[model samples]
Target: MIVVISGLIFYFVIRRIRKQIDEMAEVLEDIKNGNGNRRILSETHEIVAPLAYEMNDIITSYENRLSAFRETEENNRQLMTSLSHDVRTPLTTLIGYLDAAQKGIVTGRDKDDYIETARRKAHDLKDYIDVLFDWFKLNSDEFAITMNQVEAVELTRDILIDWIPIFEDKQIDYSIDIPEQPFRVNLDSDAYLRILNNLIQNVISHSHADKIGISLSKQNDKIAILVRDNGIGIGKEDLKHIFERLYKCDKGRSEKGSGLGLSIAYQLVEKMHGSITAESEQGRGTVFQVLFPLAD
Candidate 1:
C-alpha cells in the first residue's frame, strides 16, 4: 500500500510540472508572436514560481525598451519631415531673392532690400544648419569632452563680458552677479561655454523678455548658475518637453528654429557631470538653473 501511495504522489508531481511547462511554452509563443505583454503567472507555492517571476520581469524590461525604441523612431521621422520643410521654405525664398537681384527685377533701394533680406535668410539658414550639426554630433557616440579643473567665477565673468555688448545693443536690461571668491570646478570648458551660450541664445531668440539676470553662487559642494529672463514664460505643457529633441514650444510653422538647442544643452550638461532645469510661469518669466560639482 505504501509503495502504491508513493507511486501516486510521484505521478501527480510529474503532471503538475508538465502543466506548468506547457503554460510557460504558450506564454513564450505568444511573446514570439509579438505579444510582449504576455507573462507567466504562477502561485508562490509552486516550484516554478521563482522562474516565472524572473521571466515576467525580463519580459517587462524588454517591453519597456521596445516601447522607448519605437517612440524614438517616430520622433526621428517627425524631425526629418519638419527639417525638410523648414529647410526648403527658407532656401526657396533665399534663391528667389538672389535671382531677382541678379535679373535686375528691381533696382536701387529695392535691389538693396532684396539683397539684405537674402542675407538675413542666409544667416538664419546657417544658424539652423549649425544647430542641426550640433544635435547630430551630440547624439553620436564619438563626441569627445575634455575635462579639466578651472576657476568657475572667472570663466563665467569672461564669457559674459562679450555678451554685454549684445545685451546693450538689444536694449535689454541685464545684470550679472558673480561673487569675488573663486570657485573651482571640473568641466569641459568648451562644452560648458556652449551650454551657457545656448541658454542665453534661446532667451534672446524666443523669450521676448526685456530683463535678463545672471548670477553665480556656490552651495555646499556644488556650483549654481542661474539665467533668468522676465519674458514670455513657457506654458506648463511645453515646459515638460523642452529638453526633448526637435520639440518646439511655439505652435506656428512660421516659428524658425531647429528646436534642438535645449536638448543639446541638456546633453552637454550631462556629459560634463552637471544638471539643468527650467521653471516658468506664463507671462511671468522663465529661469534656467545649472549645477555642477565643485572641484576640491
Candidate 2:
C-alpha cells in the first residue's frame, strides 16, 4: 500500500512539471509574435522559477528599447514635417512675388514695390537656408572649427563696427561698450563672429525694442558678452525652450526666421567651452549673456 501511494505522488509531480513547461512554451511563442507584455509566471518554490524571472527581465529590457526606438522615430518624423512646412510657405510666397514683378503685374511705384518685396523675400529665403545648413552640419558632426588663442576685446569691437550701419538702418538705438584693453581667450574666430551675429540678428528680427545694447567685459576667470533689448519680452515658458532647435516664440513682431539662430548660438558657444543664458520679463525686455573661460 505504501509503495502505491509513493508512486502516485511521483506521477502527480511529473504531470505538474510538464504542464508548467507547456505554459512556458506558449508564452515564448506569444513573445516571439511580438507580444512583449506576456510573462511566464512561477512561484518561488517551483523548479523553473529562476528561469522564468530571467526571461521576464530580458523581455522587459527588450520592450524598453523598442519603446525608445519608436519614440525617436516619431520625433524625427515630426521634425521633418515641420521643416517641409516652414520651407514651403516662405518659398511659395517668394516665388509668387518674383513672378508678379517679372510679368509686369503692376507698373510705376507698384512695380518697384513688387521688385523690392521679391528682393527682401529672396534674402530671407537665403538666411533661412543658411541656418538650416548650419544646423545640419552641427548635427552631422561636420562642423570644423580651428581654435586659437586671440585678443577678444579688439575682435568684439571689430565685429560691432560692422553692425553700426545696420543699427542705423533699422532705426534701433545702440550702446556698445568694448574695453580698449586686450582680453585673451581661446576661440574660433569665424564661429565667434557667427555667434555674435546670430544673437544680434535675433534681437533685430524678434525684439520690437528700438534700443539694443551690447557690452563685453571680463568677470573673474571668464569673458562675458551681453546682448540686451527692450522688446516685448519672452514669456516664462517660451524662455525655457528658446535654445532648443526649431522652437520659435510667436512673440516677434517681425518674426520671419528659421527659428534656429539662438539654438545655433548656444551650441557654438558650448563647443568652445562657453555658456549662454537669458533673462527676461513679459512687457519688459530680454537680455542674453555669453561667457567663455578666460585663456590661461
Candidate 3:
C-alpha cells in the first residue's frame, strides 16, 4: 500500500510538469510565428520566470533591429534610384551632342555649341558625384567639421560676391539684406561656404526664378539666414521630402538637380548646431530659413 501511494504521487507530479512544458512549447511556437503576444505564464516563478523575461526581450530586440534595417534599406533604394536618374540625364545629353557631331548635324557655331553642352554635362556629372561622395562620408561618420568663431555678415557678403557673376549670367535679380555690424557664430568656415554654395546653386538651377532674396539677421543668441525665390515653388508633397536623400519633385523640377544638394546642406547645418526649414506655395515662391546659434 505504501509503494502504491508513492507511485501515484509521482505520476501526478509528472503529469503536472508535462502540462506546463506543453504550454511553454505552444507559447514558443507562437513566438516563432512572429506573434509576440503570448508569454510564458507559469504559476511558479522559480522555474520559468527568468526564461520568459529573456524570451520577451529577445523578441523585442529582434523587432526593433528589423525595423531599423528596413528603414535603412528603403533609404538606400531611394538614393540609388535618384542617382541613376541624375546620371542618366547627363549621359543622355552627352550622347545626343556626340551623335549630332558625328552625323554632321552640328557644324560651325552649332558644333561648338554642342561641344560646350557636352562639356557642361560632364562637369555637372562630376559635381553630382562629388556631392554623393560628400553625403556618403557624412553618413558614415567619417566627416568632421573644424569649427571656429567667425562673423556671419562677412561670410554671407563674401559668398554673395563670389556668386555675383553667376547671378548676372542667369539674368536673376538678387537683393541682399544684411547688417554691416558683425554677428558671430562658431561654425566650420569651409562647411558653411559649401552649404551656401549648394543652396545658391540649387536656387539657380532648380528655382528658375527671376528674383532671389537673401537676408541675414541676428536675434538674441541666434543668427537667421533666409533665402527666398519667386520661382515655380515646391509642391506640398515635395516640400515635406526636400531634405531626404535623392528625393526630387515633379518632372520639370526633377530634371534640375541630383537631389543631393539640399540633403548635404541639411546634414552640414546640423553639424554646425543649426537647423534649416523650408516654406513654399505652388505658384508664389519658396523660402529656406537657416538658424545658427551665436557664439557665447
Best prediction by TM-score: 1
Locate the minimum summed-lDDT window of 10 residues in model 2: 250-259
Return whichever of 1 and 3 wins on lDDT.
1
Query: How accurate locally, in lDDT, is each candidate?
Result: 0.90, 0.88, 0.85
lDDT of 3 at 31: 78
* Native-to-model Cα distance after best TM-score fit, residue 274 in candidate 1, in Å: 2.7
The residue-by-residue lDDT of candidate 1 on 105-149, one tens digit each, is: 989999999999999899889988888888878767889999999
- Report the lDDT tens digits of candidate 3 across residue range 109-174: 999999888888888888888888888888885678899999989988998897778788779998
Best by lDDT: 1
lDDT of 3: 0.85
Which pairs of residues collide in candidate 1? none
Arrange candidates by lDDT, descending.
Answer: 1, 2, 3
Better of 2 and 3 by lDDT: 2
Q: What is the lDDT of residue 294 in candidate 2?
A: 89
TM-score of each: 0.88, 0.77, 0.80
* Residue range with the least summed lDDT across 10 consecutive positions in model 1: 250-259
